[model samples]
Target: VGGAWFAGDCAALSECYSAGSQYSAAPILPDPLVLPTVQHLRESWDDYQDAVEDDPEVGEDGFIFDFAPDELHKANISGATHEIEMVQYVADPVIHGVTGRSGITLVEYLRVSISWGGMPGWSFKPDQAPAALAALRVRPDF
Candidate 1:
């Protein structure tokens, strides 16, 4: 149920979504959850591309050398069932092993399941989720 999506050669809306799910296993959520998740990813990708386009410093290769986490969009969705949450964030290329260039911004989407009764509750460490999730890279079409 966990995987990474890379938008390596995605350059269009359809391509972007295709790439987003290419590396991941088939989603288990119903359409209600899946549709919105896709929308969020698409919007985030668009925002990232817009930021890159607006940056005067972007190189001919379409990479922003001075990228920052805040420059990328941040969003979250709480499932209707209230048992899952999806989070999207900008991932650091160096940490994620996406590319050698520090300016290449990668986005990561994570699906976390909530548990109500346990010492740790969640399967993954909340504090360390960012680092762990950031390692998952999605290559959005630019």
Candidate 2:
């Protein structure tokens, strides 16, 4: 009866927005239970770029790197939903293989970068300190 009311209204609005879709499968309803804070994949990209510059093989421009789709997981956040557990940033470059050749060896290349941020469950309410620190695991989408 509490947050569920808000969740229901949100669901209704979402359905209304999604009216008369030509798609076969129903659009996934956004989960009401899980909430998110200020997060973005762009930051991850930037960090990756920085790491690449540090590598001798990657050169100044980052034209050689490839990005993968972001992945999400549960990532324990015990106290507040907005709280971040831990965020790990990774970027890698992949090298392609060519067809048959003589004795020459042509190898593909890859560059990887990683960074982390945020603490989970840090109660803004001042009381739940221990639980917050204990929840210091990586965030799902990091």
Candidate 3:
């Protein structure tokens, strides 16, 4: 998706038992983390969307701005990426609308709280999203 994409994986190479009789410690491998350092968007300002970007009434700051393309396009028309930017979120639980794909797949977050604000960062802001992000439908490979 657009905005940014980064990821990291921590695989245990070995474990040791703790005083309580539990294998609590694991030695981490080198370069245990992998993630993007820059921010990018999967979707960009295409020619057809230039209008939406230029429309004074509906562009940029509209209360319910739809980033749909002006003409026929796959992402927008097919709901594969009908991105929108409303003046507010109101916790609608949806942002990017798409089919054959989870609308919130790229937006939905996990372990978002005080502790995770610093993973790629400790912040829940969308700008801080890393490759480790996922949707509810996804499963963590333990």
Top model by lDDT, which number?
3
Candidate 3, overall lDDT? 0.29
The Cα RMSD in angstroms, rounded to one decimal, for candidate 3 relative to the true structure is 15.7
Q: Candidates ranked by TM-score, best first?
A: 3, 1, 2
Which candidate would rank higher by TM-score, 2 or 3? 3
Q: Write the per-residue lDDT of candidate 1 for residues 21-49, one digit (tens) a residue.
A: 33134221111111124454456557657
Q: Write the per-residue lDDT of candidate 3 for residues 22-125, one digit (tens) a residue.
A: 22231211111111222322233343356676775545454433333211122112212235554565645343543222454223332221133222122323
lDDT of 2 by residue, 23-137 (tens): 1242232212222212333454566667767885654443332222111111211112211112223232222211121221111110001001121112122243333233332
Cα lDDT of all candidates, in order? 0.26, 0.25, 0.29
The collision pairs in model 2 are 86-139, 93-110, 93-111, 95-108, 95-109
Candidate number that wins on TM-score, 1 or 3: 3
Better of 2 and 3 by lDDT: 3
Candidate 3 TM-score to native: 0.24
Instruction: State the TM-score for model 2.
Output: 0.19
Residue 76, model 1: Cα distance from true site in angstroms: 13
Q: Pick the candidate with the highest TM-score.
A: 3
lDDT, candidate 2, at 4: 13
After superposition, which runs of candidate 1 have C-alpha atoms over 4 Å from their true positions? 1-36, 56-142
User: Against the true structure, what is each candidate's TM-score?
Assistant: 0.22, 0.19, 0.24
What order do candidates take by lDDT, descending? 3, 1, 2
